[model samples]
Target: MSKLPLEGYRVLEWGLWIAAPTASMMLGDLGADVIKIEHRVTGDPSRGLDAGYGSKTGRQSLYEGFNRNKRGITLDLSKPQAKTVISKLVQTADVFITNFRQSVADRSGLDYETLSKINPKLIYAVITGYGSKGPEADIRAFDGLAQGRSALAMQAIPEGPVWVRPALGDTVAGINAAFGIVTALLVRQRDGKGQKVETSLLSSLMFQQTSNLALHFIGSIPVAPIPRTRPTNVMLNMYRCADGKWINLYMPEADRFWPNFCKAMGIEHLRDDPRFKDIWVRAQNSEALVSVLDPIFASKPRHEWIRILKEHGCVIDIINDYADLPGDPQVIANNYLPEFDHPNYGRIKYPPMPVEFSATPGQLRRPAPEFGQHTEEVLLEVGFSWEEIAAFKEQKVI
Candidate 1:
């Protein structure tokens, strides 16, 4: 196999939960050597997060899922010796990442300025809830809060605001942070200097909603968002089938697809119906059209409709939930989720990064490490002798 793109790079990360550690994992997937620094007291809080869902053993599946292909160590940064250890690590690291709030970062000497002074070529990435200079810079933020602040929750609901699940804000922000760090590395290669890269959940969430924002800002028109429950385009909506399965139709051009769609659904006579004649009429009478088509769709199973609609070249798809994803043909064919033999979870699967490369593909090199699993190993690499490492441990500064 070809070497991954980030081979030979080294990353030192201090992150909890998702954002910074996830960004480090991205680098690790592409073959960077990432060393995660955790608190000696509890390690990453995410490790025991599964307990809330009744996994009594405090299963770290959530942490393992996001933190693949990295080494880990424990550290208590409150100790003065911890700063010395970080300074030594910074001297050789290509990138350093942290998700500490502004006040905490500054006080602990983990701010970009301090670390950059140790290694001028180090790419410092700071993940935050908001931008560093904003009024809310010191405030803690999580996926849901950022989603709410960025109006992502509002857009998701369409009817009224509600938080979107599955921690989209953290995932997007981590991806963006990884992208930013890579871009900074490229810039450093050209300029012979590294820079601080900043990204936030708020920024990432806002950028993810760019199309809607463009509709508001660039279109220069009063905004009226579409409600998913009552979408104007009847064709661009989801319907339930007789077997209680749901499917979605996304035919954008009503004039073009209407006749074929109607014929496929055995409702050809309604194609020219006065109430549902054109796109404009359909928008105005979508509810009435839905009322007419509801039982018609419920008359057949989802698979049958899929076959019929596909035969007629109508753009349609089954609405797959999470339970259906792992076994999906497209997902398997594309290797979107790859299976691995995990030590704890047995044969498990993980979603791969969305990107692929012909020569330098991403990889799953190793599983997430146990807490402090590599403290002695990593410290030795950074020039700490066995005696010094033992002393650091005794001082709770590892």
Candidate 2:
């Protein structure tokens, strides 16, 4: 098989929930061998966070989604023997990821300082709420809080930042960590050494709004003199369809597209309308345009509008929910959704590795493991004896 970007890499994913797990998933997509370490009894807290819907938990979905093509192991790292086992795994691991709080990792003996000693060439990746070193580092932060403090919510929504249904911070930081780890791996390819890489939800939020942040240092940006209450209601906006579906009309300027869009909506007169020919005129006439177009759009179903606007090449998108995302034709054509058989769940659906390889393609090799599923085997790889393993299990340490 042709070698993928990370064909020879060994990654140990000691992460819970969104960010860190997503990074591991990316590596798995690129053909790296990843080992996901979980506690023996509880596993990741996210596993149980979802209540059983129809007697099946979303946790099952998350485990499969975030952690396909990876090995799983159970260890009670609280035990000395487990730490010994991990030290050996570190020796072979090229990349190590953890989202544990600094205090927790330090207490658990998984801090970079401790693990780096075992494998100085390991690329250590970290995802934090705020950051590892800051006044707010020790303070607990979630995506909503970061989005709020970073002015993302205020600038966009204004009423109050809505808690995103999905964990955007985790996914963004995960991508950052993925890039950082890959860069570190590339550096190691040249210098034959490893380095530390870190990202935080707050930092990722700020990065996502780099343009907004730059306004502070450079100068204040000119806000369009539109009497819009929220940013979403700017020049481009979402319109509700007759069937109660929403479509985004996203031409941020009163340009060719906007006129074409109004024409498509059967209100071609808007092109010559006195209050909307220029951007300034459109700014004064936004409410009138929305009022006129709303009923016209409501006269036709979203599907019909989609077809007509698409023919004319208007920039539009049908608002998609979770179900719509997976079933999208483009997503399917791109092979973004991949399914595999799980040990307990039988056949399961998981998002495929995101990278494409024209040669030997990447794959989702394994369903997420059962709790501590590979403990004995991984310990054996590190030269631990049966007696030592038994004693550690008896002590509830791994």
Best by lDDT: 1
Relative to the true structure, candidate 1 reaches a TM of 0.97
Candidate 1 residue runs with Cα over 4 Å from true position: 222-225
Q: Write the per-residue lDDT of candidate 1 for residues 1-398, one digit (tens) a residue.
A: 67789999999998889989889999999999999999888788899888878887656888998899999999998999998888888998999998889788888888888988999999999889988886788899998999889988877555678888888988888999999999999999999898999999999999998888898899976555576445789899889999999999998887899988889988888889888889998888888888878898999999999999999999999899989998899998998888888887788888787888888898887899998999999999989999999999899897
- Global CA lDDT computed for model 2: 0.78
What are the lDDT figures for the candidates, one per model?
Answer: 0.89, 0.78
* Among all candidates shown, the one with the greatest TM-score: 1
Backbone clashes, candidate 1: 0
Cα deviation of 393, candidate 2, in Å: 2.0
Off by over 4 Å in 2: 52-59, 215-219, 222-235
Candidate 2 local lDDT, residue 274: 88
